[model samples]
Target chain A: MNIVENFDLFAPRLINKKELLSGGHRACSGCGEVLAVRLMCKALGENTVIASATGCMEIVTSMYPTTAWEVPWIHVAFENAAAVASGVEAGLKALRRKGKIADCDIKVVGMAGDGGTMDIGMQALSGAMERGHDMLFVCFDNEAYMNTGIQRSSGTPMGASTTTAPAGKVSMGQKTWKKNMAEIMVAHNVPYVATACPSYPLDFIRKVEKAKKVKGPSYIHCFSVCPTGWRCPSDQTISLGRLAVETGIFPLYEVENGKYKLSAEMPKKLRPIKEYYKSQGRYRHLGEDEIKMIQDRVNKEYKKLLNKVQCLEAWS
Target chain B: MAKRVGMEVALAVAEAVGQCNIDMAAVYPITPQSHIGEHLSDLVADGKIDAEFVTVESEHSAISAIIGASGTGARVYTATSSQGLMLMHEILPIASAMRLPLVMGIANRAVSGPLNILNDHSDIMPQRDSGWISIFVENGQEAIDVSIQAFKIAEHKDVNLPVCVNIDGFQLTHMVEPVEFPDQELVDKFLPPRVPFASLHPSNPVTMGAFAMSDYFTEILKAKDEALKNSKKTILAVWDEWAKMFGRTYKPVETYKADGAEILLLTMGSMGETAEIAIDELRAKGMAVGLVKLRLWRPFPFAEIKEVLKKAKKVLVTDRAVSFGGPGGPVCGEIKAALYNEAERPAIYSYIIGLGGRDVTVGDFTSMIDKVNREEVNTDTYEFLGVRE
Candidate 1:
């Protein structure tokens, strides 16, 4: 199969004049979240509305009268991105019916950070999806509350040190495991749920394209690397995202109509988890035992995911 | 001609909102407020209203979704009770700041500690500073009237702020009463299609709810305050036009038999109706007492309140919520603040009553009046009218 040709079929034409997200915002150099948002906006095109939660992205992109968004965007309070998107979709539908607006296809997108998504925003996200609103909810998971000074979030991986969960004599960084948000979204039985990384633009773009075409609710869990929050060199952001997937820590996959498919094939012999862990300063304090624990957890989870994908393949 | 019909207050509110020809409604079910959502959904499902009814999971989501829809230039509505109202509190200010012109029905209920879901003023009092235009309803007619007018007042070009209609939960919301449903033609003429001030559209992109720094934050806040304060003009104008069309007059602070009265009582929401009865009873006994009902709660009718209370020798203010060791009740506190600098003022007395759905009979009002007349109340603090202790 010519996979590249298939990818091109769904790929959005990148137009300079129609750039939905403009440059010259206040995002830090090598910020992974902004990069992911740029690609996401390109995929969504001009016929889209974004409801961004209060975070680094919202704060950076929109400050007073100046805005980086070329398309219509709203930033309500934190924890209501999905709810806002739900309203946008509903409002557009009503307008179209009344002939107040042309019947142009418009996609509503809800954008939020890890803390906003897994912590404060969970209820609204779940509600919007359960109601089956025609919208896309993208969670840019940076693993911590980077906008609020790098506090530990529910999405922060276990043994990863944050300002709130500092590595000390008695403490071993974050105590709990990262909540599986993609799986939780799938449990909602939404029409489309996918995991993508900005490191691989084609995979991320393709997932967003598929999500846009889906009739009902779609969730995209985008793995956004935070160089500042993770205490890594700015230039290593993309490489860190690539390492996260290659090491079996963050796999790329899509769940369409409850059928799971692994989009990025994993190597038979996975790279050591230490390659991804040692590269970032947040995981620098981890002992040998902690690394082994994380390795065991990642390997186990990967095997379970592979089994599910294989089982679905057999059924098909 | 308008027709009188008997219906549950919540359903009447729903029907009135439907008649306004709103584009969308996002609702989350909560006690006393759920009936409005149910009726609106039914109206949409039955094809009586050409609108989208999104049954959201929580009040927080409901408010958020309506914000989005309203931002998209679609007239939207939502309803909530005490806890649910509290859940939507964070975004309430945003809706006003963004100037979305969304209409909300708040069935006033007691805030939880004892987990009470009954009628009280605690729910709407906290939202006083949220920058939305708030109005209190005394009965089903007012519930239907204020709800329909809320859309007009909020969407008015001059006052482009959110509006909340507060109806006493269970006390007024669940009560079945006679209401006048205005003709569809009249409603359509009164409220035209929403003319969005700055709506979200691909053809005309605009950023809303942008972050403000210290250089412009205070100025932005000042602008919002000025917008709310100026909204009073639009509110009164809308009420005047409504009266002209519907023949039902409403005032910011409505007075009942206050002429030449020595003692006066003030109340808000459904308690005003009970207070009116008490005033009649007091009048029969030849007591020089009358009642003042506060309909407008936010951008408080300060001048109107002062003008009415200025004539009385003694004013007794009744509040449904406590201020918790502060100066008396919230309403009484505002009244005192409003009249503090005046050259001459009535001797004020604050009475907290009807908390957590506790019944306040006419007798209780009369006795309370008697206690105040005899100088029996604690002058330093507010008296709880019906507390057992």
Candidate 2:
């Protein structure tokens, strides 16, 4: 479908205009993570239940009686969101089997921040995937532990300024490179795994729709920018996300089973990594050599991902 | 008519689970309790039972898988011991709060630090407040009998909470005894199909385990508390129904020969049988002592315990579990709390004993009662029984 036609056909059909994520949320104004969640909920529609971990999304939305969520939601401990959602999905299925529930399409979604996804919740997530449960696992990658005061997470980009990986004279920011979670998810050989960005709302919606159609486990790794944590202007959330994809720092792709398809392939002449980095204050302290080091690492990782995708396509 | 057969407590539990026609079992092998899962898996594989047996990686996943399977409105069962029980601790509350009638066999063993995998109540004691109904079986026969009863109690509409059937690890689980296996037809008649209050159904959809705000959180918690407390009567009713069919009686707290006794020895799990022998010797010596076996740990059996203790001048509470820094053991602390306001409450002395499968001889029980009489009940807590240097 053409861009306009695609928007006309898919946007309204998928968009859940009912704002489940209401305003007045304590989330920092223009929090990209919440926007991504808002858009995702809209795409998934109302017949859905969410299991959230103890993270920024959970803390900010569920403040006693004043909940931002309009949908039925559960906030279990940090590492057990996947496990809890597994229970919810199983409970729903059992009820269906017993004729307690009528035939209605329902979705179980798990939302976790980077730390919850790639670190603490990893085993539970792996187990859930291995079990082949019908559910969606969404990882809002803000790179650092924003809610817990910007600690380093596996999703934290190399040379990024986080509380645990602070920039100093002898060292750059985070020394470790960002973990390729989408690839890791694909390695699980699940039915679907896709990468998306909030900046590309239509693209993100498409991935959500695709994941919903998949029979078994699906993973969507959304590149969500944290304006407050990244030391960028609140309004720059969407623009930074766009810059990430355009600069080839966060390429969009989908892996269905073992097959790979690049969703948004940029031209060979991409924007400089510096353009993407310099926009945020997290990378402001990076010296010339450190910047080059980060750029080299990013280039190598991007090339590796591209090669893997290309090899898979060639074999298929 | 099914033929009666002698079976180990673990095997009897497995056979009962199969006979009950459980839909699914997620199990991880742990000492003592491992036979329950192993036997169940074999039964399922051999086509003796129609069920899904999931061999999980860890005790955490075993419980998590059972929670998932049970949530689906399928009858589910699993078994675990000491550290394994501790590992599944996180999922325990979830299972209960969701109102899933999940029945688990807990082979009671000491919790590890120095790593002992033998009999003790330390394991299941920590899980008392997690909202699961805990039933302690003193012998092999009771283990099998209570396991079947656990399903009925758990699935009862009034008592829709998970039930833990606690059998002392090697002492009960490994010991073979004469267990009357109820006919499958009789079991079917007594325990009907589980009608879950809520489940993962597409039609008539209702949210379970929804996040409650402070405005509604207290109400939900209060409801859970009320459900558990109100279930005491339902539990009694189920026991009565079970006894009528199986021809064996059960009580929340069973008083063994405690009529007008001056010294009351209170014990739980397999240690009660050992204490019974000691009680016989003490009674013969004119010590005026009797034994009270705590069959139900959760829902505490408070009123019955108070009633039984009223006739005794001194009560010796023997615990197979220790509560490190706390007064007495965990069970003793709970018993004290239950009896605190009673006007005629007897002098309660707590003794920590039989930890890590240490054999409890008749001498240990006799000496403990003698010490209780001679020493003026000086301390509310003492670990003098089987205390190692």
Candidate with the greatest DockQ versus the true structure: 1
The DockQ figures for the candidates are: 0.88, 0.28
Model 2 CAPRI rating: acceptable
Report the lDDT tens digits of candidate 1 across residue range A1-316: 5866765665435423356789999999999999999989988888899999999999999988789999999999899999999999999999999999988999999999998899999998998899899999999999999999999999999999999999999999999999999999999999999999999887898789899999999999999999999999999989999899999899999999889998854456779999998878999999999899999999999999999899988888
Off by over 4 Å in 2: A1-27, A45-49, A60-73, A89-108, A168-171, A265-267, B21-23, B46-52, B68-74, B94-100, B202-223, B374-381
* Residue B201 in candidate 1, Cα distance off native in Å: 1.4
Q: Against the true structure, what is each candidate's TM-score? A: 0.97, 0.90
Residue pairs in candidate 1 whose N, alpha carbon or C atoms collide under 3 angstroms: none
Candidate 2 achieves a global lDDT of: 0.82
User: Model 2 over residues A1-316: C-alpha lDDT tens digits?
Assistant: 5676767676666566688777887889879999999989888877777778888888888776567776777665677778767766765665465555566667888879989999988988888888887899999999988998999999999888889999988778898878889888998999999999999988898899888888889999999999989999998998999899988899888999888887854556667789998879989999888878777877887788789789998898
Q: Among all windows of ten consecutive residues in candidate 2 chain A, which has the lowest summed lDDT?
A: A92-101
Task: Give the TM-score (vs. native) of candidate 1.
Answer: 0.97
Error of 2 at A144 (Å): 2.7
lDDT of 1: 0.91
